[model samples]
Target: MLDRSESALRVVVRSKFYRSAFLALLIAGIGLSAATPQLTLFLVRDLGTPLPVAGLYYVTNLAAPVAGFLVGRWSDRSHDRLLWFRVCAVIGSVGWLAMAAAQTVWLPFVISTVALSLAGGSMAQLFAACRDELSRHPTKAENRVIATIRMAFTVGWILGPVLGSWFGGVFGLRALLVATAACVFAQMLPLGGQRVERYEDPGISPLPEGRRRLDHMMPLLVFTAICVLAMTGDTIKFGYLPIYMAEQLHVSDSVRGAVIGIQPLLELLMLPAVARLADRYGPLRIMTVGAALGLAGNIAYATSSSVGGLFLGQALTAGLWACVGALGVSIAQQLYPEGVGTASGIFLSSIPLGSAIGGAIGGIGVAIIGLPHVFFVPAGLTTLALVAFVVLTARLSVRMKA
Candidate 1:
């Protein structure tokens, strides 16, 4: 088995196309990840926005991905992946500029939200292009490639927050935004004058005589909804976890920083193993495991008093999140074959929306019930999502067979 896998890796790495695309994705991760948690924390801690309000700020930004979805869908029909990616980069850069220049909270909110939405929204389109270009495999191999692409973003997440914290702490939030914009520019350099091949829109269905019908894609709409629901449980940890750590565990700001830094690193570290698992067991099995781990971790968090307890819970949560983040994109790739760009946009948007909802719930729970309750709600929600994931995926497997 090891020999077979090594042989496969050798074949793939030898391809110039895969290497170039992977390099592009690696650079892209550095830029896109830079602003994520830092911006939210800045708004809450420095800008004096309350937790719930800060959450709403993020929720507003989620609309940008929705726009990306619409734009990507249109691009799909036109078969223009490169055009969409470029447009998204331009819009995202402007958003970062807005973040850097805004005098008031609302101004940054507007700019950052739009910028994040567009930039993030276009990622699916980019992956779709990459996937189409690398369509050289059986189903399992293709799924592994998709999983690896998503894992690349986990690497971005690992770096983004650490850099954001170091830069934001040392210089300022504005400087961090500018740096992120610069990264975006650098990442875009490789794609210059390259025409991206767009895949068949996954949103489209198979019709009579082997033609795909749009109506058959409706099941995927629900699958996307499930993705959104599961992700909310995730976002809560990102947007509100720092505050909770500061207040509940009474950890120092630096310790809080360490905790934040730890999550993405753990996630990135785990992806290769998770990717192998997804290939062997299928995405549904991996997702169910992720959801269950998240549920248990969050529930344990509710009872945690010591810092060690929090760390244990967080480690489990982060590991599970890594699996979902990688495999979710793979599933999305399968579901939205034709409209990959648009579908990717739609799929990516769910994370922020989930974050928004989770943040809102956490904020309210912290304020009224206490921090432990905040942990409890997400745990419960994750458990429900796990059950749903199991049922849905089991049904999806059946549908595929039929």
Candidate 2:
């Protein structure tokens, strides 16, 4: 019995589909994280855009969900998701190159917006691919696989910023952009004609003719929206916290970088345990706890008057994100297994959408009230999201019992 179990375990551990999906996601994460920290800085410092205007640049993210939804729907219908994946990588590479060569503010704005949007769409496709891969191997824990992918991403983030800072500091932001483009293109080499098998469950029949699919999907959709609202707090912090540290706290660039890097590093420590809890308790429950932690973190930020307090708040914030970031995709994949691509797209799009709206609002709030006071806005948003989510789960439970 032990030998048979061990043999089965080896087969799962050595699965090509699982290994390939994780590798692709890890590389993509490296490319994205390496460039992300420098983007707003490049615009504000190099291109002479104000913080508020730079914040407005994220407004372009409003259009990304549409792009994601379309690409995801198309990926669901397409035979070769790998083909679409390669195309997206190419598009993202070109966008990075355009950003590298951009002389004017509008050019970078347009390129960043379009490139990141395409990248977001690509990510949706990738999640669908991963889910398809996961479907083929039933013995593997689905949430665990998802958490492992997120760990890959967190690992990339841990390395990317340090690399970006070193590269950008030494060779300039253009060189950094070029390197990022290379990283994006490098993700393509690993594919090597590997195709994701489409998912089809034999036991589950199609929905009846009169039942609207949208009706069945509404609860999850509402849940996604609430999650987005909660995410806006993190977005606000990402958009403005570095600036706050630099301008308000008068920290040096190196210190600022360390402060920014610490969150993901701490997150790396938390993910493995969080993944286990998610597997045991369900993703939503873990997410709820994370949301509460996020609220506390935001409040800490609002009250913080020193660098130590800021760091403390950021640590809590990292804990919050580590939970949601891993589980959000898992929940979305579970909720809409039939259209994993579309569901994942919607889930993926929420990040940027939340960031765009939050950054815009944060920028305006900073301009009006002051940087220190802006933290309260996100706290309020998170509170509302948590309330809505609790109500939603309660209603769902009542219905289930009935």
Candidate 3:
């Protein structure tokens, strides 16, 4: 009876670890999404910046990827991943608070870089810690776990816009920013002082020294390239879709908000099924299908003439994003088991890198050609990603079979 009771206690404790991690991710997502959607608008309305300049402000978000990679690499070497998370959360909270107080453009710009980067780094560390914990347990399904995390993030995305709009409407953007800081600080409470056991796969043997470096580097490179392309296209759509709805379609702010909200809501519905499929069929295959969907969705966005068409485009994009969110991290963890933290950092960084490039290019495109035409660029980029994925996967399969 004592043994049985002890076993049950261990099980409960193990379950709590995963639950806490998921909750932290959910809260992080809420904080980020709440302020991000309105940042461009805030810059324009409050700071008197031009639309193009406001859009370009996202280019400064390059801090996220840079910090994500560095922190991830550090976590790989460090024994206590949660400690890094706590430090990052504190830094991010300070940054958000500062942003709330900033009256000048330069202060927000400089502070945002520090705050967002640290926050991103914290998320990367959290993911790496979760992956390590999953690996240690082995009974937990990685794809399912990843899917749950994605769903949590999707839920946050769903709530974030509503909260942002409500808080901004009721109080102001500064209040919304302050709320975001509070959310970031809240994550530390659940995750602080929690340490996860690290596990390295015993099945993988050391490669021959001559071929070792090349073989190790190739997978990371392939994963990074694919992620960069996918993120670039996605960020372009995310950054400019609102503007396109308002300026090109002459939609009301409420309509634009609804349209923006639809994608994540659909994603929340799709992620569970997508995770099941990814676990069964493999993340790489599902990711390919997702890339194709992204291409199609971008094309739809570029050509749509009616509100119905816009809805269809966003629906398809949501499905694609669900696949990416569910599968991408799982694939990264699988590919680089030893350096999960470093790989995750690299993978997470792709978002900011893509966002920076996408924002800069989208801003320029909007200035040169038109708002609707900017999506064409992502459509074209997605096509290239598809082509590369097909060719690379085919060769990889042949090698594996050999």
Top-lDDT candidate index: 2
Model 2 error, position 172 (Å):
2.5
Per residue, candidate 2 scores C-alpha lDDT tens digits across 10-70 of 4435877556666667787787788887988888777887876776777888878777777
For residues 1-402, could you state the per-residue lDDT of candidate 1 as single tens digits? 123254324434665545555666777787767777677676776677776566677667557556756766766766566777777777777777767776666876776556666677556667767666655333345545655666666677667666777888899887887888877766667666777666453445522223343454455566666765665656666656676778767889878777667767788777767767776777777878888888778876778777777788778888677776777766765665655665666666667677767767776777877766678887777777888888888877743311
Deviating ranges (above 4 Å) for candidate 1: 1-12, 40-55, 136-139, 200-214, 252-255, 399-402
**Candidate number that wins on TM-score, 1 or 2:** 2
Q: What is the C-alpha lDDT of each candidate?
A: 0.68, 0.75, 0.75
| Clash counts for the predictions, in order | 18, 0, 0
How many Å off is the CA of 319 in candidate 1?
2.8
Model 3 regions lying over 4 Å from their true place = 1-14, 45-51, 202-215, 251-254, 395-402
lDDT at position 171, candidate 3: 94
lDDT of 3 by residue, 1-402 (tens): 112112222332468776787788789888888998888778887777777667667777777766876787678778777777887888888888888887776777887777767667787777888777766665334666667766777788788877888889999998898999999989877765678755556875532245774577467668767767765766767767877787778889888777777888898888877876765666777778888888888888888866677788888888778987887776776666667787787787776787787777776776887767778888888888888877766765433211
Question: Model 1 shows how many backbone clashes?
Answer: 18
Q: Candidate order by TM-score, highest to lowest?
A: 2, 3, 1
lDDT leaderboard ranking:
2, 3, 1
